[model samples]
Target chain A: MTYCLGIVNCFGIVIAADSRTNAGVDYISAYKKLFDFSVPGERVLLICSSGNLSMTQGVITELRRDIQNHEEVNLHNLSSMYDIARYIGHKSRQIQDRDRQWLERDNIDFQCNFLLGGQVKGEEPQLYLIYPQGNFIQATKETPFLQIGETKYGKPILDRTITYDTPLEAVAKCALLSIDSTMKSNISVGPPINLVMYKADSLVVRHTLELRLGDPYLAKMRKLWEDFVRQAFEAMPNIEWQRETEASVEDILID
Target chain B: MTYCLGIVNCFGIVIAADSRTNAGVDYISAYKKLFDFSVPGERVLLICSSGNLSMTQGVITELRRDIQNHEEVNLHNLSSMYDIARYIGHKSRQIQDRDRQWLERDNIDFQCNFLLGGQVKGEEPQLYLIYPQGNFIQATKETPFLQIGETKYGKPILDRTITYDTPLEAVAKCALLSIDSTMKSNISVGPPINLVMYKADSLVVRHTLELRLGDPYLAKMRKLWEDFVRQAFEAMPNIEWQRETEASVEDILID
Candidate 1:
């Protein structure tokens, strides 16, 4: 399992992912799920993947091979973020097509999902959640975030906090907190979190951080968030119990 | 779709549920999911249901009918909370068994789940999650809460705050917040939210609330929680950026 999120707002874009993957409870391992395929001055592109390890690796390898081999259509050459998303979705579908039969024969799930966030030279920063079926949906002004893989446990916070005009740095912090919430609720999503923040119109990636297991920053942030959440909960007003006597009085009056 | 939660701590048991039911987006209606069958001064029995509307309704109807008709084995006659859980599960299984073939022919899901929480005269208060297969598991000291239906959105807070030692009132508040979080994230779970709080050894339930749509208290709590959560997020420490120059120096050293 994996949890990857991409947030695109007026200020910039933030993409984050957890590194843990498990074929089963006993077969868990850490892997880099975020990849940077930026051209520095040309465009900024980041992809976060979740689902079948072999299938995603195949898609990533093929994408890199296309770039290294300078194939006509590649991540570096795509003119628009939409086109790049389409290319990644196409590659994902291809990998699934190649292995779906074998996986199905063994009753294994071969589906994979990807979150592609980037900015091309002329367009605004964009985020897209590419489906396993080669379809994709982009984030918009009203809903400025997209998530994939173990999504629900971390979604309420995003729904409550993210807006199109949120500051870029604050969005990054929310992304980390979102993943931290998921990690606390689910064992499938663990650490070595990868985060990248790309400022709008920059056409380059400058800020990146990888929080490994037992990272002090991660521990400190977790402790602080937990404390604050408890404090917030404690601050919530107590429930006003509706007394049974009053209800009975109302009931007798109705009768 | 539904969201129901039951939290059992040393102080007492709190059970809460949303009242929304839907066949699809087009067909949403409200029905009470929390039912009290408490024989005051004897047992405090509260049950919350989730899953297929017809199946859960059928289970509830039959449980009521058995008690009304004075059947040989009824909920009122059950000696322990475990037996009561088993009795509810048995009724649930019977309903599913009756409808299984017809539902399967149309590819409809016939499964249902129940959270039965209460105390019998001789036994301590208990909470059990009864599965579709007529089996159940009790909440334990290590994990003092059990939730059914649309549970994930509200789970992080529970994971962060709930324990066996939590006060009953606080647990009740947590249950409300948990359901509120779910309602915020999902449209299928909505008001009027039903809540029941039972103090240990008080077998009779004296505190309950049904928060309808646009209830002032509910609105106020929602606003306060949003404010507090934002304040909490703002209070969180910002990420310390690891400069590219530092990373490059470390890379040079490694090389």
Candidate 2:
């Protein structure tokens, strides 16, 4: 029950992930899901994970280990965004191999998914949704954003709002609205959000900020959105045909 | 894939369901998911099914057969809304008993769920979410709704809008908003919505409306909601404290 979303806009890339992780209701804890792998001015990539905490953390650690030994393939050494997806797949597969047998024995699904996006020094910004099976799909003009875990509740706003030509700031707004919707419905997705944005071509990490508990702006946005929706609900016209026990002028109809 | 929702409002009840049912993309068909049994002034019962179409259809058929047989237990003869729930559960279990052995041999999990809500003569209106296991839970003043199948996309707006005391017309509006959101994200849940409403204690249905693909009012509401979201998006502040590319804002200040 996690939420991680990434959007590739004309100006750059936007990445957002919630911090809640749970093994069960009692084991709930905060775990940072966003990882930065880019070298300033050389490459900038933000990767977010959602699902099996153990499996995702395993993949992240594997990537970090790969980066440490330049001889091994990793995000820092990869020349293109597509290679990033392959490398992530390879690592995820490696970890799945270790647990696949055990997971099947217990009837526990080894479920995990990830959103990997950012710029390599030479290429345009890119976004990819890496599935639990160690395969991945890159976002294109038709689908300029990718989400992983608990995605449906937040999808309509994203499907309607995001575009390849959208400005970076507006992308942030869409991402937040998406998160706002998810957090409102799911208790397991409580947030102290990890939000990051990378400017196109600059290849350096520009904004990698965390809004922890008690963050003012998120609180304000939640209230403002709720208030707006309440007002909108009131503004909708009452059904012209429905009757009242005690009829009023609004209930009157003419044929 | 399907989406079905039910709402209990001050004026009455609103139930709406999509008509799409698919075994696979190539096997998709339009099958109605909503069924109502109303005996004017005596009782009104609405049922929406999501999951295995055959299993749900079986349950529907069994209930109708009971009615045809003049069975002692049917919505028409049930003493209270809870009794109606038990009847649905009993029949659902009967269907499962017939199907489970064959389904298990094929290695497919048992999949089915139902949401039943309405009023019987001499009893208050009630809503219940019936599980495949024959257990049920009723909605309370704090939670005045139930949803079945592909439910998440529509759930957020419900969290933001529905209450036990919400007016009947407003409940219908909210139900549309909910189903509309589900349809926007899920292609498997599509057009020709079946929406019904019942006022408390009146027994008979008050409104059983249809919203088709080209319905003008629904189309207008979708556009208005999208526009309103766009306006709300623009009103939010662009975080000024975001780091810049020329020099890391952190480097400039921290150094």
Candidate 3:
């Protein structure tokens, strides 16, 4: 299991991912799940992946091979962010298909998903969630985020806080907090966390941070968020349990 | 799809559930998911269910039938809360087995889960989560809550706020807020919400509240939580994005 998310706001986009990967309880290991493909002045592409590790590695290997071989349709040759999403999705599906038969025979899964976020030199910064089936969906102004795995525990915070007009710094903080919530509740998702913040028109990645388990700043932020949440919960108004009539209250009570 | 939870604290136990049931998006309807069986001075049993509606209804019907027919192992005749949990789990599995073949032939799921909490005359109050396989686990002092169906979106709050010594009223509020979070993130779980609070050794449920979609207290609490969360997010320290060494930051940057 993994937790990775991408947020798109007015200032730019932020992509964050957890580094824990496990084949089973005894086979746990750390693997970097975030990859960067940036041409300093021309384009910037960030890929955050989750799902089957083998399939993700296969897709990444093919992507790099294409770039080194200068294939007709490589990441560096892509004209738009959407094209890059399609290309990644295509590669993911191809890799999964190669192992689908044998993996399924052994009752193993061969699917993987990716969050593609970045800017092509002439295009605006964008974010896309590419599915294992080779289909993809782009983020919209109303829903300015896309998540890949172990999403639900961290989603309520994002649903309430993120928007297209949110500032870049605030968006980065929310992304880290979202991953933090997931890490606390789920053991499959652990640190070090890889985070990247890209300013819209700058064709270079800036503000990249890798937070390991006991990093001081990460620890401080986690404590602060936990304390704030407790305070918030303690402050909510209590339910008026005595105001309702007896008959209505006992409607479902069997005696 | 449903979201129901049972919380046991020092003062008592609080049980809450959403009322939405659907065969599919086109066949949505409302059905109460919480049931109570209290014999004023003798015993008080609460059952909150999630999963296949028909199976839960069947199990409930069997329980009532046993009581009405004066069966040797009915709810009223049970010796302890643990026995009651075992009875409910047995009935649930029996019902599922009855429909298993036919349901599977049509690709339908006949599984269901339950949360059983109550106090019998001479026994201490308890909470149990009964799985589809007819096995159950009781909640402990360290973990005082049990949840079933659509649980992830609402779990973080409970993980952060609930404790064995939490006041009954505060526990009730936390349970409501947990369900509220689930409803906000999942359409499959919705109002009107059912809540019941039982004081330890009382052997009866004293406070029950049904909150409709726009109940004033519910509305106020939701707004306050949302506002407080936003305020908390805004108060967090911003990440110092530029202080790190450029070389370390750019190590993963592909060009």
Cα lDDT tens digits for candidate 1, B68-99: 99999998998999889989988999999998
Using all chains and alpha carbons, the TM-scores for the candidates as numbered come to 0.94, 0.91, 0.94
For model 1, name the residue pairs that clash.
Answer: none
Measured as a fraction from 0 to 1, the native contacts recovered by model 1 come to 0.52
Q: What share of the true interface contacts does each candidate keep?
A: 0.52, 0.38, 0.40
For candidate 3, write residues B1-255 as lDDT tens digits. 899999987888999999999888788889999998878777889998988989999998899999999998999898988888888988988999999999999999889999998898778789999999999999999999999999999888888778899888888888888888888889989999999999897776778999988889888888888888777778888787643445542454454
TM-score order, best first, reads: 1, 3, 2
Worst 10 residues of 2 chain B by lDDT: B246-255
Q: What are the lDDT figures for the candidates, one per model?
A: 0.89, 0.81, 0.88
* Most accurate candidate by lDDT: 1
- Name every residue pair that clashes in candidate 3: none
DockQ of all predictions against the true structure, Cα-based: 0.42, 0.35, 0.42
DockQ of candidate 1 against the true complex: 0.42
- Candidate 1 ranges with C-alpha deviation above 4 Å: A244-255, B244-255
Q: Please state the CAPRI-style docking class of candidate 1.
A: acceptable
TM-score: the better of candidates 1 and 3: 1
Q: How well does candidate 2 score on lDDT at residue A87? A: 83
lDDT of 3 at B28: 80
Give the better candidate number (1 or 2) by DockQ. 1
